[model samples]
Target: MKRALYQRLTELYNAYVDTFREADGKLPPMMELKRIHTAHVVANARLIAEGEGFDAETTHACDAAALLHDTGRYEQLKRYNTFRDADSVDHAVFSHDIVKEKGWLDGDPHRESILAAVLYHNRRDLPDGLDALTLAAAQTVRDADKLDIFRVLEHQITTTDWRHNSQAFWNLPTTARPNPVVLDDIRSGRPVAYQDIRSLADFVLIQVGWIRNGLAYATTRRLCAERGHLAFRRDFLHQLTDDPAVDELCQYAELPTQGVS
Candidate 1:
């Protein structure tokens, strides 16, 4: 049953990608970026599920949720020309609606759990009282989603040409300094809200700050270290900021020890 469900999900994902493929056999850069990111999240989700010793059925459900978690991103980019939820619609809600409207999970026995996971994967906080199965699935997707985001951020920071993808920088000025309020939230061990991000430096600080509130599994932390994501972000932040306070915040975040297993 798990194998069959996995196969069905692969087919659905392929069809979705086909929708965005250009007639000339190319996807717009953003579409391709998201498509590839979704693939990584699926792989990361499976790794988390296996590390957690989930049964085949639970693992399959989690994988489905990961694949569909960003289904709304493509549409959001097309409709709003941006990925910022504040500037546009909430992508999570849009994804949940698309899953239902398309009946993507209608016949699955774990449909409710899958949908719930996708809907809450991007939320600031998961609601109270989610059933154990739903919570596990949601948390799995959330961790996997965040793990890959670090990979994306690492790539974006290194590549350095924002012209092709201004949205990736949230259109904040690259020269702008970090907002103190945003820094305070991170210092308090909380994830910074989108509204508080006023500049590229604040954005980077929030990404580093995610280490405090975004992680959901021990295995995810190990994976972040193994993938060199933790070290990359730490180094990138050091290069981007000269303020001693930002350095202290990075230290407080425990930027992962370098060369330590």
Candidate 2:
């Protein structure tokens, strides 16, 4: 039963992406980035579900949530030309509205749980009163999203012509000094807001900080350890600044040590 649902959800996701193609039948560069990111999130979600031993039905619901989690990005970019929620709209809310309007999960028995997971996946803090299943699904989506984000940031920071894909850089200046406020947020273990990011370094620091706060699943931590994501960030920050404080902050993230295949 859940397998059938997964198939339908994949079809819906493909159809949705098709609507966003440019006049030449290609996605705009940023839109293309989002398209690929969504695919990775779906794959990561499946992996997380399997790693954590979720039941078949719950796993399928998570797969659905992951596939549709960022559906708002296409419309948000088209309408506002920005992915920063503070500059435009709360993408999680927008994504929820899109899924609800499309009636994507209209008749599924797990519809509300799926929708609730999608709605809160991007939140800094999950709301109170979510049932155990709903909370687990939401956390799975969140971990999947963050895992892909680490990949995105790694590419963005390394590529020479990243400027050509300015939206991926969030249009921030590529200066070396991290914003003090942003650094403080990381050091003090507080959630960093998008609006507070004043430079590219601040953005990178925020990503590193997310290692400490953004994670929700043990599977995610294991994957990060296996992927060497934690090591990559630590080294990336060391290259960015020789400050001992930054090293301490990176150490505080406490990512796993085992290598993932």
Candidate 3:
């Protein structure tokens, strides 16, 4: 995980994605979006690692993990023409397999940890009993991933018609009422389960749920706040529907998350 090694991985990542872009006249819009997202996630990972004062080796390892975390996405789109895991494969696991098959992590001291982090990055909850370094690496990428996702999700919600981006919105109704289970999860301070979300309004609330309870580091939370991600979410939610639950969840979203203030 030295500086030179990290540079090598960066090159490898870019070249890997470039193959897909080169084959087509231009990358598909969704593919291009993921390419951009991988870069931003890497940047966000570095921000969190440095903000948390990770040592050089650990920080470099984290950055490598971030860069390779989405390795399977290109192939996923090619094979299934959709990003939905329920319809195809778990992209995280698919990413993990690609990393392994390519031997991309070979010779890196933190290779296994990075693989573990990639595999678990999209899980509903990380399993308990992971080693400390592995846990930190996983949590760093997960938070980093979410930090950028707020930006991506906000852009998609605000700029485009959700009707056309059904895959991104779980093909749920754009104006349907939030699911009762989703509302309960918010009121009770639990992460919103993807299975419970039945509408775009519910989908937006899932992001707020991330604000209230999902981010893993205070620095990540601060970055989220500084970016006004949560504020935009609040505005977006009201547009979807007027409900007392939105008001309640908004209050919790404002309360300072526990940990380094």
Candidate 4:
């Protein structure tokens, strides 16, 4: 992958998302949210790639994947007006389709593996035995994506009430008590699944788990820590409930970055 090609892909992504803008040339809030997010994910990917000492082409591939990872979200919103995969389409798979159909990565040397990263990013598990290049791209984008999402969640909840950010909160019931399954998932060092999230607190708790075990790189852990993502999530949960397990799960986040990939 060439840096020039990556730059072209970035331009293409920007112009594509521009189609979602309203008459005033302002993207709707949700579209703007994702547009900003993709930018930061690319920035975050750059940090991780540099910290991990990736070679030039590998960094190029990872950055391209990061920029294009959410390509389908704009189309998904236009078609269904919802980000919920169950309510509409799986954004990740849709993103892969859009990028492929557009031939954005057509001549890149590592096209297939980069596309695989985009395709499998939202899945619960990646297929085992991926090539080193494919694994690098996939892990970089996933880790970068999750790390920034914690920031986005915290910002939306803090700047506005959950009632106003229904898209972010997914219409979950307001409750102080988190679902036992979500707490148990964290307690056992497992990432919480979407179906398992009950209250808004449960959703935050799942992101907290990402700090502990879900991150694929030590650099990601350090970036998340530096950004205070864990502290915000932990503090939010503490305000919501007196559950002692909140502290227990948070302690895991403080532990040294566990076994970076």
lDDT per residue for candidate 2 within 1-261, as digits (tens), equals: 888887887888789989989799999989999999999999999999999999987898898989989989999999999998988999999999999999889778889988998899888788999887888789899999999999987887677564444456667765457878888998877888777887666777887777776677778887877887877877876765666767777777773542221
So what's the TM-score on candidate 4? Answer: 0.94
Q: In candidate 1, what are the lDDT values of residues 174-249, reduced to their tens digit?
A: 6666788898888887667777888777887876666655677777777876887656766765665666667777
Query: How displaced is residue 74 in candidate 4, in Å?
Result: 0.9
What's the number of clashes in each of the models?
0, 2, 0, 0
TM-score of 2: 0.89
Worst 10 residues of 2 by lDDT: 252-261
lDDT of 4 by residue, 1-261 (tens): 286898798789888988888999999998899999999999999999999999988898799899989999999988999888999999999999999999988888989988999998887778999998899999999999998888788778878776545556877775648989888988787767778887888988888877777889988988988999888888888877888888988887798846356
lDDT of 3 by residue, 1-261 (tens): 288788888888778887887554578888998988998999999999989998887787789889988889999999999888889999999999998988878888888889999999999889999887788889999999999999998777768777656666768887788898999988777777667888888988988888888888988988998999888988888887887788788777878854323
Clashing pairs in 2: 226-259, 226-260
**Descending-TM-score candidate ranking:** 4, 3, 1, 2
**lDDT rank order:** 4, 3, 2, 1
Candidate 3 TM-score to native: 0.92
Per TM-score, the best of the predicted structures is 4
Per-candidate local distance difference test: 0.81, 0.83, 0.86, 0.86
Against the true structure, what is each candidate's TM-score? 0.89, 0.89, 0.92, 0.94
> Residue 210: error of model 2 in Å?
1.6
